[model samples]
Target: MYTIFHAVFGYFFMLLAVRVLVRRPGGQLTPFEFVIIFLIGGIAILSTIGHDPSVTNCTCAVIAVGMVHRFVAMARTRWRRLGRWMDGLPLVLLRDGQWQLDAMEGMRIEPDDVMAAAREQGLTSFSDVKYAVVERTGSISIIKR
Candidate 1:
């Protein structure tokens, strides 16, 4: 029963970390967002199935980060400028049917990634994507030209 208790709590709370902390924040990914996921995964594993680090320790850390995430989300929404700092606004990968190779390189996304996204949308040529945005959530958002 005790084992089940820890496992359930950690599992559900991890969902909160993903939902409220990550998606609800901005539906986008920034470097900070990546870090939060990496840390949460490490803590979740140790707490869910390991004993060296107690479940309470993991829960506490998760709660703390969750609170901060929520605060940032609220702040970003309330203040437009702050939100931009906390959550990166979308970047244009293509404009007027032209690829922005420099932006793609800076964002560390290869051309193939864009092509794959395009193919998913039935776009066989570059001109089909009017604007491709690499969202703050580290996901790609494509708008067909």
Candidate 2:
């Protein structure tokens, strides 16, 4: 029972934490980011299993977490509003060679990141960018003029 409870709570806690802490949409995870994620997984396991090292307890906890994940994914697909609430809507960082400073600031996106996306898209400068949006997945999408 304790393992099940922890599994459910940990799932939601990590969900919220990720939404708050991670801003880069689809950006490659830095080594530090990767370590943090790995540590979180380890902590979640410890919390969910507690002192119980039994296979049954661990198995039940894993199942509970997996089920909740599947339910959330299904709910997001079925309900657009829920999906938007969970994942957030994409924000326009640049449009028509003009920077949307407020939006960029809100998302903590740096100019270099936007410029990198533009360069990847074969744009020499923001002047050649029709649109640059921070996608929900945390990666920049650049549309060239």
What is the Cα-based lDDT of residue 63 in candidate 1? 63
lDDT of 2 by residue, 38-104 (tens): 7887988889899998999989998999999999999999999999989999999998768899998
Model 2: residues >4 Å from true position, as ranges?
A: none
lDDT, candidate 2, at 57: 96
Flag regions of model 1 displaced more than 4 Å. 1-40, 43-59
Error of 1 at 68 (Å): 2.4
Model 1 agreement with the true structure over 24-139: per-residue lDDT tens digits: 23444568777888898788766655664566666655565566567767877899997665455677777776778887767767778778778989989777888888787657
Top TM-score hit: 2
